[model samples]
Target: MKLLKLVPDHTNIDFVRLRGWAFGLTLLLSVLAVGVTFARGLNLGVDFVGGLMIEERFASPPDLTRVREVVDAQGLGEAQLQTFGDPRVLTIRLPTQDGADEGATNAAVKKVSAALTQAFPGATFTRYSTVSGKVSNELIRNGVLAVVLAILGIGLFAIFRFEWQFGVSTIVAIVHDLLMTLGFFALTQFDFDLNIVAAVLTIIGYSINDKIVIDDRIRENMRRYRKMDMREIINLSVNETLPRTVMTSVTILLALFALLFLGGHVLRGFTAAMILGIVVGTYSSIYVSSSLLISLGLRAEPGEKKPARVDLSNAERIAPRER
Candidate 1:
Protein backbone atom coordinates (compact mmCIF):
# COMPACT_ATOMS: atom_id res chain seq x y z
CA MET A 1 0.00 0.00 0.00
CA LYS A 2 1.12 3.52 -0.76
CA LEU A 3 1.73 5.16 2.60
CA LEU A 4 2.37 8.61 1.13
CA LYS A 5 0.91 10.53 -1.78
CA LEU A 6 3.01 13.07 -3.65
CA VAL A 7 2.05 16.72 -3.56
CA PRO A 8 0.74 17.91 -6.92
CA ASP A 9 3.24 19.52 -9.25
CA HIS A 10 3.68 23.32 -8.88
CA THR A 11 2.74 23.25 -5.23
CA ASN A 12 4.57 25.86 -3.16
CA ILE A 13 5.65 25.28 0.43
CA ASP A 14 7.98 27.38 2.63
CA PHE A 15 10.53 24.77 3.70
CA VAL A 16 13.03 27.24 5.15
CA ARG A 17 10.51 28.61 7.63
CA LEU A 18 9.33 25.15 8.63
CA ARG A 19 12.88 23.92 9.13
CA GLY A 20 13.73 27.02 11.15
CA TRP A 21 10.89 26.46 13.60
CA ALA A 22 11.64 22.75 13.96
CA PHE A 23 15.32 23.43 14.59
CA GLY A 24 14.47 26.06 17.17
CA LEU A 25 12.21 23.67 19.05
CA THR A 26 14.78 20.86 18.99
CA LEU A 27 17.46 23.21 20.25
CA LEU A 28 15.27 24.41 23.08
CA LEU A 29 14.33 20.90 24.18
CA SER A 30 17.91 19.62 23.92
CA VAL A 31 19.19 22.48 26.06
CA LEU A 32 16.49 22.01 28.69
CA ALA A 33 17.09 18.24 28.82
CA VAL A 34 20.83 18.71 29.22
CA GLY A 35 20.27 21.09 32.10
CA VAL A 36 17.97 18.63 33.83
CA THR A 37 20.48 15.80 33.40
CA PHE A 38 23.30 17.83 34.92
CA ALA A 39 21.17 19.05 37.78
CA ARG A 40 19.85 15.61 38.65
CA GLY A 41 22.19 12.70 38.04
CA LEU A 42 21.10 9.62 36.07
CA ASN A 43 20.18 6.48 37.91
CA LEU A 44 22.97 4.17 36.79
CA GLY A 45 21.93 0.53 36.57
CA VAL A 46 23.62 -2.58 38.06
CA ASP A 47 25.88 -2.60 35.01
CA PHE A 48 27.43 0.65 36.21
CA VAL A 49 27.48 0.23 39.98
CA GLY A 50 28.89 -2.94 41.54
CA GLY A 51 26.00 -5.10 42.80
CA LEU A 52 24.00 -8.34 42.59
CA MET A 53 20.80 -9.12 40.63
CA ILE A 54 18.31 -11.75 41.73
CA GLU A 55 15.39 -13.11 39.72
CA GLU A 56 12.53 -14.95 41.28
CA ARG A 57 9.35 -16.52 39.86
CA PHE A 58 6.24 -16.98 41.95
CA ALA A 59 3.08 -19.04 41.37
CA SER A 60 1.25 -15.73 41.06
CA PRO A 61 2.22 -12.08 40.68
CA PRO A 62 4.06 -11.20 43.89
CA ASP A 63 3.28 -8.02 45.83
CA LEU A 64 5.96 -5.42 45.05
CA THR A 65 5.55 -3.46 48.29
CA ARG A 66 5.68 -6.60 50.40
CA VAL A 67 8.76 -7.83 48.53
CA ARG A 68 10.53 -4.50 49.00
CA GLU A 69 9.76 -4.49 52.70
CA VAL A 70 10.96 -8.06 53.14
CA VAL A 71 14.19 -7.39 51.27
CA ASP A 72 14.75 -4.12 53.09
CA ALA A 73 14.11 -5.85 56.38
CA GLN A 74 17.11 -8.11 55.70
CA GLY A 75 19.37 -5.02 55.74
CA LEU A 76 21.18 -6.42 52.71
CA GLY A 77 22.36 -2.94 51.71
CA GLU A 78 19.96 -0.99 49.46
CA ALA A 79 17.70 -3.18 47.33
CA GLN A 80 15.25 -2.43 44.54
CA LEU A 81 12.56 -4.91 43.50
CA GLN A 82 10.51 -4.78 40.33
CA THR A 83 8.56 -7.17 38.11
CA PHE A 84 10.17 -8.56 34.96
CA GLY A 85 9.20 -10.94 32.14
CA ASP A 86 5.77 -12.19 33.32
CA PRO A 87 3.91 -10.66 36.24
CA ARG A 88 4.95 -13.68 38.26
CA VAL A 89 8.63 -12.89 37.76
CA LEU A 90 10.48 -10.50 40.09
CA THR A 91 13.97 -9.05 39.78
CA ILE A 92 15.87 -7.56 42.72
CA ARG A 93 18.90 -5.26 42.55
CA LEU A 94 21.03 -4.55 45.61
CA PRO A 95 24.25 -2.66 46.28
CA THR A 96 27.19 -4.46 47.82
CA GLN A 97 27.81 -3.43 51.40
CA ASP A 98 30.82 -1.17 51.95
CA GLY A 99 34.12 -3.00 52.45
CA ALA A 100 32.09 -6.13 52.55
CA ASP A 101 34.04 -9.33 52.11
CA GLU A 102 33.00 -12.05 49.62
CA GLY A 103 31.36 -13.80 52.50
CA ALA A 104 29.36 -10.72 53.34
CA THR A 105 27.96 -10.36 49.81
CA ASN A 106 27.04 -14.04 49.82
CA ALA A 107 25.48 -13.66 53.25
CA ALA A 108 23.42 -10.69 52.08
CA VAL A 109 22.14 -12.59 49.07
CA LYS A 110 21.30 -15.60 51.18
CA LYS A 111 19.45 -13.45 53.73
CA VAL A 112 17.42 -11.74 51.04
CA SER A 113 16.70 -15.05 49.36
CA ALA A 114 15.48 -16.56 52.59
CA ALA A 115 13.30 -13.55 53.34
CA LEU A 116 11.70 -13.64 49.85
CA THR A 117 10.90 -17.34 50.18
CA GLN A 118 9.29 -16.75 53.55
CA ALA A 119 7.29 -13.71 52.39
CA PHE A 120 5.97 -15.55 49.35
CA PRO A 121 5.84 -19.25 50.12
CA GLY A 122 6.21 -21.88 47.34
CA ALA A 123 7.89 -19.34 45.05
CA THR A 124 10.81 -20.54 42.92
CA PHE A 125 13.87 -18.26 43.04
CA THR A 126 16.89 -18.03 40.79
CA ARG A 127 19.98 -15.89 41.40
CA TYR A 128 21.54 -14.35 38.33
CA SER A 129 24.43 -12.19 39.43
CA THR A 130 27.26 -9.79 38.52
CA VAL A 131 29.63 -7.32 40.16
CA SER A 132 28.26 -3.80 39.74
CA GLY A 133 31.53 -1.84 39.69
CA LYS A 134 33.03 -4.02 37.04
CA VAL A 135 29.86 -4.12 34.98
CA SER A 136 29.47 -0.33 35.20
CA ASN A 137 33.01 0.43 34.08
CA GLU A 138 32.87 -2.10 31.25
CA LEU A 139 29.52 -0.82 30.04
CA ILE A 140 30.65 2.80 30.07
CA ARG A 141 33.78 2.01 28.09
CA ASN A 142 31.94 -0.14 25.57
CA GLY A 143 29.16 2.41 25.10
CA VAL A 144 31.62 5.22 24.46
CA LEU A 145 33.53 3.13 21.96
CA ALA A 146 30.36 2.03 20.17
CA VAL A 147 29.16 5.61 19.66
CA VAL A 148 32.55 6.80 18.48
CA LEU A 149 32.89 3.97 16.01
CA ALA A 150 29.37 4.50 14.74
CA ILE A 151 30.08 8.17 14.06
CA LEU A 152 33.35 7.40 12.34
CA GLY A 153 31.76 4.70 10.21
CA ILE A 154 28.88 6.97 9.23
CA GLY A 155 31.25 9.80 8.39
CA LEU A 156 33.25 7.54 6.09
CA PHE A 157 30.10 6.21 4.44
CA ALA A 158 28.72 9.71 3.91
CA ILE A 159 31.98 10.90 2.41
CA PHE A 160 32.00 7.92 0.08
CA ARG A 161 28.33 8.19 -0.95
CA PHE A 162 27.92 11.96 -1.08
CA GLU A 163 30.33 14.48 0.49
CA TRP A 164 32.22 15.28 3.65
CA GLN A 165 29.57 17.82 4.52
CA PHE A 166 26.92 15.14 4.32
CA GLY A 167 28.99 12.86 6.55
CA VAL A 168 29.60 15.61 9.07
CA SER A 169 25.94 16.64 9.18
CA THR A 170 24.80 13.02 9.48
CA ILE A 171 27.17 12.41 12.39
CA VAL A 172 25.99 15.56 14.11
CA ALA A 173 22.38 14.48 13.82
CA ILE A 174 23.24 11.02 15.15
CA VAL A 175 25.01 12.55 18.12
CA HIS A 176 22.07 14.86 18.58
CA ASP A 177 19.78 11.86 18.85
CA LEU A 178 22.16 10.02 21.17
CA LEU A 179 22.58 12.92 23.57
CA MET A 180 18.88 13.56 23.59
CA THR A 181 18.23 9.92 24.49
CA LEU A 182 20.82 10.12 27.27
CA GLY A 183 19.20 13.27 28.54
CA PHE A 184 15.90 11.43 28.77
CA PHE A 185 17.48 8.64 30.78
CA ALA A 186 19.14 11.10 33.11
CA LEU A 187 16.03 13.17 33.58
CA THR A 188 13.90 10.12 34.36
CA GLN A 189 16.73 8.45 36.31
CA PHE A 190 15.95 5.27 34.40
CA ASP A 191 18.39 2.41 34.77
CA PHE A 192 21.14 3.05 32.23
CA ASP A 193 22.52 -0.39 31.51
CA LEU A 194 23.93 -2.63 28.77
CA ASN A 195 20.48 -3.07 27.27
CA ILE A 196 20.15 0.68 27.08
CA VAL A 197 23.47 0.88 25.31
CA ALA A 198 22.08 -1.60 22.80
CA ALA A 199 19.02 0.63 22.41
CA VAL A 200 21.18 3.68 21.77
CA LEU A 201 23.10 1.85 19.07
CA THR A 202 19.86 0.75 17.47
CA ILE A 203 18.69 4.37 17.48
CA ILE A 204 21.95 5.55 15.98
CA GLY A 205 21.60 3.13 13.09
CA TYR A 206 17.95 4.06 12.57
CA SER A 207 18.51 7.83 12.76
CA ILE A 208 21.34 7.68 10.24
CA ASN A 209 19.11 5.92 7.72
CA ASP A 210 16.61 8.77 8.02
CA LYS A 211 19.38 11.33 7.59
CA ILE A 212 20.65 9.56 4.50
CA VAL A 213 17.21 9.59 2.89
CA ILE A 214 16.85 13.36 3.32
CA ASP A 215 20.42 13.94 2.24
CA ASP A 216 19.85 11.89 -0.91
CA ARG A 217 16.85 14.06 -1.71
CA ILE A 218 18.90 17.20 -1.21
CA ARG A 219 21.59 15.89 -3.53
CA GLU A 220 18.97 15.03 -6.13
CA ASN A 221 17.53 18.52 -5.86
CA MET A 222 20.98 20.00 -6.46
CA ARG A 223 21.03 18.28 -9.85
CA ARG A 224 17.38 18.89 -10.74
CA TYR A 225 16.75 22.48 -9.68
CA ARG A 226 19.81 24.02 -11.25
CA LYS A 227 18.68 27.62 -11.00
CA MET A 228 16.94 27.66 -7.61
CA ASP A 229 18.38 29.46 -4.60
CA MET A 230 20.00 27.22 -1.94
CA ARG A 231 17.39 28.00 0.69
CA GLU A 232 14.53 27.46 -1.75
CA ILE A 233 15.95 24.20 -3.03
CA ILE A 234 16.44 22.82 0.48
CA ASN A 235 12.90 23.79 1.31
CA LEU A 236 11.62 22.01 -1.74
CA SER A 237 13.64 18.92 -1.00
CA VAL A 238 12.36 18.77 2.58
CA ASN A 239 8.77 19.18 1.47
CA GLU A 240 9.14 16.43 -1.10
CA THR A 241 10.53 14.06 1.54
CA LEU A 242 8.33 15.18 4.45
CA PRO A 243 5.60 12.63 3.86
CA ARG A 244 7.97 9.68 3.95
CA THR A 245 9.55 10.96 7.16
CA VAL A 246 6.22 11.26 8.90
CA MET A 247 5.00 7.87 7.75
CA THR A 248 8.15 6.01 8.79
CA SER A 249 8.22 7.70 12.17
CA VAL A 250 4.58 6.93 12.87
CA THR A 251 4.90 3.24 11.96
CA ILE A 252 8.00 2.84 14.14
CA LEU A 253 6.28 4.60 17.01
CA LEU A 254 3.34 2.22 16.77
CA ALA A 255 5.59 -0.83 17.07
CA LEU A 256 7.55 0.72 19.92
CA PHE A 257 4.42 1.62 21.82
CA ALA A 258 3.26 -1.97 21.66
CA LEU A 259 6.60 -3.19 23.03
CA LEU A 260 6.66 -0.50 25.69
CA PHE A 261 3.28 -1.44 27.06
CA LEU A 262 3.16 -5.21 26.52
CA GLY A 263 6.67 -6.64 26.23
CA GLY A 264 7.19 -6.77 29.99
CA HIS A 265 10.17 -5.43 32.00
CA VAL A 266 12.76 -7.38 30.06
CA LEU A 267 11.91 -5.19 27.12
CA ARG A 268 10.65 -2.04 28.90
CA GLY A 269 13.95 -0.12 28.93
CA PHE A 270 14.71 -1.10 25.36
CA THR A 271 11.24 -0.13 24.16
CA ALA A 272 11.20 3.13 26.12
CA ALA A 273 14.52 4.21 24.64
CA MET A 274 13.39 3.23 21.14
CA ILE A 275 10.14 5.17 21.48
CA LEU A 276 11.95 8.32 22.60
CA GLY A 277 14.56 7.97 19.88
CA ILE A 278 11.91 7.58 17.17
CA VAL A 279 10.43 10.98 18.00
CA VAL A 280 13.79 12.70 18.36
CA GLY A 281 15.24 11.01 15.29
CA THR A 282 12.37 12.13 13.07
CA TYR A 283 12.72 15.75 14.21
CA SER A 284 16.51 15.66 13.86
CA SER A 285 16.31 14.32 10.30
CA ILE A 286 14.30 17.32 9.15
CA TYR A 287 15.56 19.96 11.54
CA VAL A 288 18.93 19.05 12.98
CA SER A 289 20.50 17.36 9.95
CA SER A 290 19.00 19.56 7.26
CA SER A 291 19.53 22.82 9.14
CA LEU A 292 23.12 21.86 9.89
CA LEU A 293 23.64 21.28 6.17
CA ILE A 294 22.38 24.78 5.39
CA SER A 295 24.51 26.19 8.17
CA LEU A 296 27.51 24.40 6.64
CA GLY A 297 27.30 26.24 3.31
CA LEU A 298 25.54 23.65 1.17
CA ARG A 299 25.18 25.20 -2.26
CA ALA A 300 22.05 24.79 -4.37
CA GLU A 301 23.50 24.23 -7.84
CA PRO A 302 26.92 24.85 -9.31
CA GLY A 303 27.39 27.16 -12.36
CA GLU A 304 23.96 28.74 -12.05
CA LYS A 305 24.18 32.37 -13.21
CA LYS A 306 22.76 35.02 -10.92
CA PRO A 307 20.38 37.43 -12.57
CA ALA A 308 21.85 40.93 -12.33
CA ARG A 309 19.58 43.61 -10.82
CA VAL A 310 18.22 46.11 -13.40
CA ASP A 311 20.44 49.07 -12.80
CA LEU A 312 18.58 52.25 -13.74
CA SER A 313 21.63 54.31 -12.81
CA ASN A 314 23.86 52.38 -15.21
CA ALA A 315 21.27 52.80 -17.94
CA GLU A 316 21.15 56.52 -17.25
CA ARG A 317 24.94 56.77 -17.23
CA ILE A 318 25.08 55.27 -20.78
CA ALA A 319 22.00 57.11 -22.08
CA PRO A 320 23.93 60.22 -23.25
CA ARG A 321 26.46 58.07 -25.15
CA GLU A 322 23.67 56.05 -26.74
CA ARG A 323 21.86 59.24 -27.75
Candidate 2:
Protein backbone atom coordinates (compact mmCIF):
# COMPACT_ATOMS: atom_id res chain seq x y z
CA MET A 1 0.00 0.00 0.00
CA LYS A 2 1.25 3.43 -0.90
CA LEU A 3 1.41 5.90 1.99
CA LEU A 4 -0.34 9.21 1.45
CA LYS A 5 1.71 12.35 1.88
CA LEU A 6 0.22 15.81 2.35
CA VAL A 7 3.39 17.31 0.91
CA PRO A 8 5.98 15.00 -0.63
CA ASP A 9 9.50 15.40 0.77
CA HIS A 10 12.16 17.20 -1.30
CA THR A 11 9.59 19.58 -2.79
CA ASN A 12 11.49 22.76 -3.61
CA ILE A 13 8.95 25.49 -2.88
CA ASP A 14 10.44 28.89 -2.02
CA PHE A 15 8.70 30.00 1.17
CA VAL A 16 11.24 32.79 1.67
CA ARG A 17 10.15 34.48 -1.55
CA LEU A 18 6.81 35.35 0.04
CA ARG A 19 8.34 36.85 3.20
CA GLY A 20 7.83 40.47 2.16
CA TRP A 21 4.17 39.92 1.31
CA ALA A 22 3.57 37.93 4.47
CA PHE A 23 5.22 40.55 6.65
CA GLY A 24 3.04 43.28 5.18
CA LEU A 25 -0.10 41.26 5.64
CA THR A 26 0.81 40.44 9.21
CA LEU A 27 1.54 44.07 9.95
CA LEU A 28 -1.77 45.14 8.49
CA LEU A 29 -3.69 42.57 10.47
CA SER A 30 -1.87 43.40 13.67
CA VAL A 31 -2.61 47.07 13.27
CA LEU A 32 -6.29 46.35 12.66
CA ALA A 33 -6.48 44.10 15.69
CA VAL A 34 -4.90 46.68 17.97
CA GLY A 35 -7.21 49.33 16.65
CA VAL A 36 -10.35 47.25 17.10
CA THR A 37 -9.35 46.11 20.56
CA PHE A 38 -8.85 49.69 21.70
CA ALA A 39 -11.73 51.32 19.89
CA ARG A 40 -14.53 48.78 20.25
CA GLY A 41 -13.03 46.80 23.11
CA LEU A 42 -13.66 43.13 23.84
CA ASN A 43 -17.11 42.03 24.92
CA LEU A 44 -15.83 40.98 28.32
CA GLY A 45 -17.83 38.16 29.91
CA VAL A 46 -19.38 38.19 33.37
CA ASP A 47 -16.13 36.77 34.72
CA PHE A 48 -14.58 40.17 34.13
CA VAL A 49 -17.71 42.28 34.56
CA GLY A 50 -19.34 40.88 37.72
CA GLY A 51 -22.64 39.05 37.41
CA LEU A 52 -24.95 36.43 38.89
CA MET A 53 -25.23 32.88 37.59
CA ILE A 54 -28.24 30.68 38.23
CA GLU A 55 -28.72 27.10 37.12
CA GLU A 56 -32.08 25.48 37.67
CA ARG A 57 -33.62 22.16 36.70
CA PHE A 58 -37.27 22.45 35.73
CA ALA A 59 -39.80 19.62 36.05
CA SER A 60 -39.72 20.02 32.27
CA PRO A 61 -38.17 22.60 29.95
CA PRO A 62 -40.26 25.62 30.85
CA ASP A 63 -41.60 27.88 28.13
CA LEU A 64 -38.61 30.00 27.11
CA THR A 65 -40.91 32.86 26.13
CA ARG A 66 -42.38 32.95 29.66
CA VAL A 67 -38.97 32.62 31.29
CA ARG A 68 -37.58 35.44 29.21
CA GLU A 69 -40.52 37.63 30.05
CA VAL A 70 -40.14 37.02 33.78
CA VAL A 71 -36.40 37.76 33.74
CA ASP A 72 -36.78 40.88 31.64
CA ALA A 73 -39.41 42.23 34.02
CA GLN A 74 -36.60 42.60 36.57
CA GLY A 75 -34.97 45.18 34.21
CA LEU A 76 -31.56 43.46 34.31
CA GLY A 77 -30.82 44.68 30.79
CA GLU A 78 -30.23 41.39 28.94
CA ALA A 79 -29.42 38.00 30.46
CA GLN A 80 -27.74 35.20 28.57
CA LEU A 81 -29.74 31.94 28.72
CA GLN A 82 -28.97 28.50 27.43
CA THR A 83 -29.51 24.85 28.18
CA PHE A 84 -26.92 23.26 30.45
CA GLY A 85 -25.84 19.64 30.17
CA ASP A 86 -29.42 18.47 29.82
CA PRO A 87 -32.34 20.14 28.15
CA ARG A 88 -34.22 20.16 31.47
CA VAL A 89 -31.44 22.21 33.04
CA LEU A 90 -31.24 25.91 32.14
CA THR A 91 -28.25 28.13 32.78
CA ILE A 92 -28.74 31.88 33.08
CA ARG A 93 -26.05 34.54 33.25
CA LEU A 94 -27.50 37.74 34.71
CA PRO A 95 -26.34 41.19 33.79
CA THR A 96 -24.40 43.27 36.27
CA GLN A 97 -26.59 45.68 38.17
CA ASP A 98 -25.46 49.29 38.25
CA GLY A 99 -24.94 49.16 42.01
CA ALA A 100 -22.18 46.94 43.44
CA ASP A 101 -23.63 46.85 46.95
CA GLU A 102 -24.47 43.48 48.46
CA GLY A 103 -28.07 44.60 48.77
CA ALA A 104 -28.29 45.36 45.03
CA THR A 105 -26.78 42.04 43.90
CA ASN A 106 -28.82 40.13 46.49
CA ALA A 107 -32.07 41.86 45.56
CA ALA A 108 -31.45 41.21 41.87
CA VAL A 109 -31.01 37.51 42.56
CA LYS A 110 -34.09 37.44 44.80
CA LYS A 111 -36.21 39.03 42.13
CA VAL A 112 -35.01 36.57 39.49
CA SER A 113 -35.46 33.52 41.73
CA ALA A 114 -38.91 34.63 42.85
CA ALA A 115 -40.00 35.00 39.24
CA LEU A 116 -38.74 31.53 38.48
CA THR A 117 -40.65 30.05 41.40
CA GLN A 118 -43.94 31.73 40.36
CA ALA A 119 -43.50 30.58 36.77
CA PHE A 120 -42.26 27.07 37.55
CA PRO A 121 -42.85 26.20 41.20
CA GLY A 122 -41.19 22.81 40.70
CA ALA A 123 -37.96 24.46 39.56
CA THR A 124 -35.03 23.62 41.81
CA PHE A 125 -31.87 25.63 42.08
CA THR A 126 -28.90 23.57 40.93
CA ARG A 127 -26.34 26.34 41.40
CA TYR A 128 -26.21 29.97 42.38
CA SER A 129 -23.06 32.11 42.18
CA THR A 130 -22.09 35.74 42.31
CA VAL A 131 -19.00 37.58 41.06
CA SER A 132 -18.26 40.95 42.62
CA GLY A 133 -16.85 43.95 40.78
CA LYS A 134 -13.60 43.82 42.74
CA VAL A 135 -13.15 40.12 42.04
CA SER A 136 -13.94 40.59 38.38
CA ASN A 137 -11.38 43.38 38.04
CA GLU A 138 -8.78 41.23 39.72
CA LEU A 139 -9.51 38.36 37.38
CA ILE A 140 -9.08 40.62 34.36
CA ARG A 141 -5.73 41.89 35.65
CA ASN A 142 -4.47 38.39 36.35
CA GLY A 143 -5.70 37.04 33.02
CA VAL A 144 -3.78 39.70 31.12
CA LEU A 145 -0.70 39.19 33.27
CA ALA A 146 -0.84 35.47 32.59
CA VAL A 147 -0.71 36.02 28.81
CA VAL A 148 2.24 38.42 29.12
CA LEU A 149 4.15 36.02 31.33
CA ALA A 150 3.42 33.13 29.01
CA ILE A 151 4.84 35.05 26.04
CA LEU A 152 7.92 36.09 28.00
CA GLY A 153 8.49 32.59 29.32
CA ILE A 154 8.19 31.07 25.87
CA GLY A 155 10.53 33.69 24.40
CA LEU A 156 13.19 33.13 27.04
CA PHE A 157 13.08 29.39 26.57
CA ALA A 158 13.49 29.63 22.78
CA ILE A 159 16.42 32.03 23.13
CA PHE A 160 18.20 29.74 25.56
CA ARG A 161 17.61 26.64 23.47
CA PHE A 162 18.30 28.11 20.05
CA GLU A 163 19.54 31.62 19.32
CA TRP A 164 18.35 35.13 20.20
CA GLN A 165 17.19 35.68 16.63
CA PHE A 166 15.17 32.46 16.64
CA GLY A 167 13.64 33.40 19.96
CA VAL A 168 12.65 36.85 18.77
CA SER A 169 11.15 35.48 15.58
CA THR A 170 9.05 32.98 17.50
CA ILE A 171 7.87 35.65 19.86
CA VAL A 172 6.78 37.88 16.99
CA ALA A 173 4.86 35.05 15.33
CA ILE A 174 3.10 34.17 18.59
CA VAL A 175 2.12 37.77 19.11
CA HIS A 176 0.66 37.88 15.62
CA ASP A 177 -1.39 34.81 16.39
CA LEU A 178 -2.56 36.30 19.66
CA LEU A 179 -3.58 39.64 18.18
CA MET A 180 -5.47 37.93 15.38
CA THR A 181 -7.33 35.75 17.90
CA LEU A 182 -8.22 38.75 19.99
CA GLY A 183 -9.23 40.65 16.89
CA PHE A 184 -11.63 37.91 15.87
CA PHE A 185 -13.31 38.02 19.25
CA ALA A 186 -13.48 41.77 19.19
CA LEU A 187 -14.81 41.87 15.66
CA THR A 188 -17.48 39.31 16.35
CA GLN A 189 -18.36 40.78 19.73
CA PHE A 190 -17.78 37.39 21.26
CA ASP A 191 -17.55 37.09 25.00
CA PHE A 192 -13.99 37.52 26.12
CA ASP A 193 -14.00 35.43 29.29
CA LEU A 194 -11.68 33.23 31.26
CA ASN A 195 -12.40 30.34 28.91
CA ILE A 196 -11.42 32.42 25.89
CA VAL A 197 -8.22 33.49 27.65
CA ALA A 198 -7.46 29.84 28.27
CA ALA A 199 -7.97 29.12 24.59
CA VAL A 200 -5.65 31.96 23.60
CA LEU A 201 -2.93 30.65 25.88
CA THR A 202 -3.42 27.20 24.43
CA ILE A 203 -3.05 28.70 20.95
CA ILE A 204 0.21 30.33 22.01
CA GLY A 205 1.59 26.95 22.98
CA TYR A 206 0.37 25.28 19.78
CA SER A 207 1.67 28.04 17.51
CA ILE A 208 5.05 28.20 19.23
CA ASN A 209 5.52 24.46 18.96
CA ASP A 210 4.98 24.57 15.21
CA LYS A 211 7.35 27.51 14.87
CA ILE A 212 10.04 25.79 16.94
CA VAL A 213 9.84 22.63 14.87
CA ILE A 214 10.52 24.64 11.73
CA ASP A 215 13.19 26.68 13.47
CA ASP A 216 14.92 23.54 14.71
CA ARG A 217 14.88 22.12 11.21
CA ILE A 218 16.38 25.35 9.91
CA ARG A 219 19.13 25.16 12.50
CA GLU A 220 19.87 21.56 11.64
CA ASN A 221 19.96 22.37 7.95
CA MET A 222 22.36 25.23 8.65
CA ARG A 223 24.78 22.73 10.13
CA ARG A 224 24.28 20.20 7.32
CA TYR A 225 24.62 22.65 4.43
CA ARG A 226 27.39 25.05 5.29
CA LYS A 227 27.52 26.72 1.85
CA MET A 228 23.75 27.19 1.37
CA ASP A 229 22.38 30.72 1.26
CA MET A 230 20.01 31.83 4.07
CA ARG A 231 16.95 32.05 1.83
CA GLU A 232 17.63 28.73 0.15
CA ILE A 233 18.15 26.98 3.49
CA ILE A 234 14.91 28.41 4.92
CA ASN A 235 12.98 27.39 1.84
CA LEU A 236 14.41 23.89 2.02
CA SER A 237 13.67 23.56 5.72
CA VAL A 238 10.05 24.72 5.41
CA ASN A 239 9.40 22.47 2.44
CA GLU A 240 10.89 19.48 4.24
CA THR A 241 8.74 20.16 7.32
CA LEU A 242 5.63 21.09 5.35
CA PRO A 243 4.11 17.64 5.60
CA ARG A 244 4.21 17.55 9.39
CA THR A 245 2.90 21.07 9.63
CA VAL A 246 -0.03 20.31 7.38
CA MET A 247 -0.86 17.06 9.15
CA THR A 248 -0.80 18.62 12.61
CA SER A 249 -2.81 21.64 11.58
CA VAL A 250 -5.39 19.60 9.73
CA THR A 251 -5.84 17.24 12.68
CA ILE A 252 -6.28 20.11 15.12
CA LEU A 253 -8.70 21.93 12.83
CA LEU A 254 -10.86 18.83 12.54
CA ALA A 255 -11.12 18.50 16.32
CA LEU A 256 -11.76 22.18 16.82
CA PHE A 257 -14.47 22.29 14.16
CA ALA A 258 -16.18 19.38 15.88
CA LEU A 259 -16.15 21.25 19.15
CA LEU A 260 -17.39 24.38 17.43
CA PHE A 261 -20.36 22.68 15.83
CA LEU A 262 -21.34 20.03 18.40
CA GLY A 263 -20.38 21.56 21.72
CA GLY A 264 -23.02 23.66 23.47
CA HIS A 265 -22.96 27.36 24.31
CA VAL A 266 -20.60 26.88 27.24
CA LEU A 267 -17.82 25.84 24.92
CA ARG A 268 -18.67 28.13 22.02
CA GLY A 269 -16.23 30.94 22.77
CA PHE A 270 -13.52 28.55 23.77
CA THR A 271 -13.89 26.49 20.63
CA ALA A 272 -14.02 29.54 18.42
CA ALA A 273 -10.76 30.75 19.89
CA MET A 274 -9.14 27.40 19.26
CA ILE A 275 -10.25 27.24 15.65
CA LEU A 276 -8.95 30.70 14.85
CA GLY A 277 -5.79 30.01 16.81
CA ILE A 278 -5.02 26.90 14.82
CA VAL A 279 -5.38 28.73 11.53
CA VAL A 280 -3.40 31.81 12.55
CA GLY A 281 -0.84 29.68 14.28
CA THR A 282 -0.19 27.59 11.21
CA TYR A 283 0.04 30.69 9.05
CA SER A 284 2.57 32.33 11.32
CA SER A 285 4.73 29.27 11.45
CA ILE A 286 4.86 29.02 7.66
CA TYR A 287 5.47 32.69 7.01
CA VAL A 288 5.91 35.02 9.95
CA SER A 289 8.51 32.98 11.84
CA SER A 290 10.94 32.59 8.97
CA SER A 291 10.37 36.12 7.76
CA LEU A 292 11.08 37.50 11.20
CA LEU A 293 14.21 35.34 11.39
CA ILE A 294 15.63 36.89 8.24
CA SER A 295 14.51 40.40 9.17
CA LEU A 296 16.34 40.04 12.48
CA GLY A 297 19.68 39.74 10.61
CA LEU A 298 20.18 36.07 11.51
CA ARG A 299 21.96 34.78 8.41
CA ALA A 300 23.32 32.02 10.59
CA GLU A 301 22.83 30.51 14.04
CA PRO A 302 25.35 30.67 16.89
CA GLY A 303 26.24 27.01 16.45
CA GLU A 304 26.98 27.56 12.75
CA LYS A 305 30.26 29.32 13.41
CA LYS A 306 32.31 30.93 10.63
CA PRO A 307 36.02 31.58 10.26
CA ALA A 308 37.38 34.43 12.35
CA ARG A 309 38.21 37.71 10.58
CA VAL A 310 41.85 37.80 9.33
CA ASP A 311 44.21 40.36 10.84
CA LEU A 312 45.31 42.53 7.86
CA SER A 313 48.70 43.49 9.32
CA ASN A 314 49.68 39.88 10.13
CA ALA A 315 48.37 38.51 6.80
CA GLU A 316 51.03 37.97 4.05
CA ARG A 317 50.93 40.43 1.12
CA ILE A 318 51.36 39.07 -2.42
CA ALA A 319 53.94 40.78 -4.70
CA PRO A 320 52.63 42.24 -7.97
CA ARG A 321 53.86 40.27 -11.05
CA GLU A 322 55.83 42.04 -13.91
CA ARG A 323 54.47 45.55 -13.54
What's the distance in Å from true for residue 140, model 1? Answer: 1.5
Q: Compared to the true structure, candidate 1 yields what TM-score?
A: 0.78
* Candidate 2 local distance difference test against the native: 0.80
TM-score to true structure, per model: 0.78, 0.78
Instruction: Give the number of the best model, judged by lDDT.
Output: 2
lDDT of each: 0.75, 0.80
Model 2: CA > 4 A from native: 53-72, 75-110, 113-129, 301-323
lDDT tens digits, residues 1-323, model 2? 99987765446666788989999999999999999988888887778988877777789878887888888887987877766345777767886677766788778777788889888988876666677788999999999999999999999999999889988988899999999988888888767888898998999999888988888888876776565567766876777677788999998889888887798656877988898898999999998898678778777544564555322221112211111
Quote the positional error of residue 254 for candidate 2 in Å: 1.1
Overall local distance difference test of candidate 1: 0.75
Off by over 4 Å in 1: 1-12, 55-69, 72-75, 80-91, 96-110, 120-127, 302-323
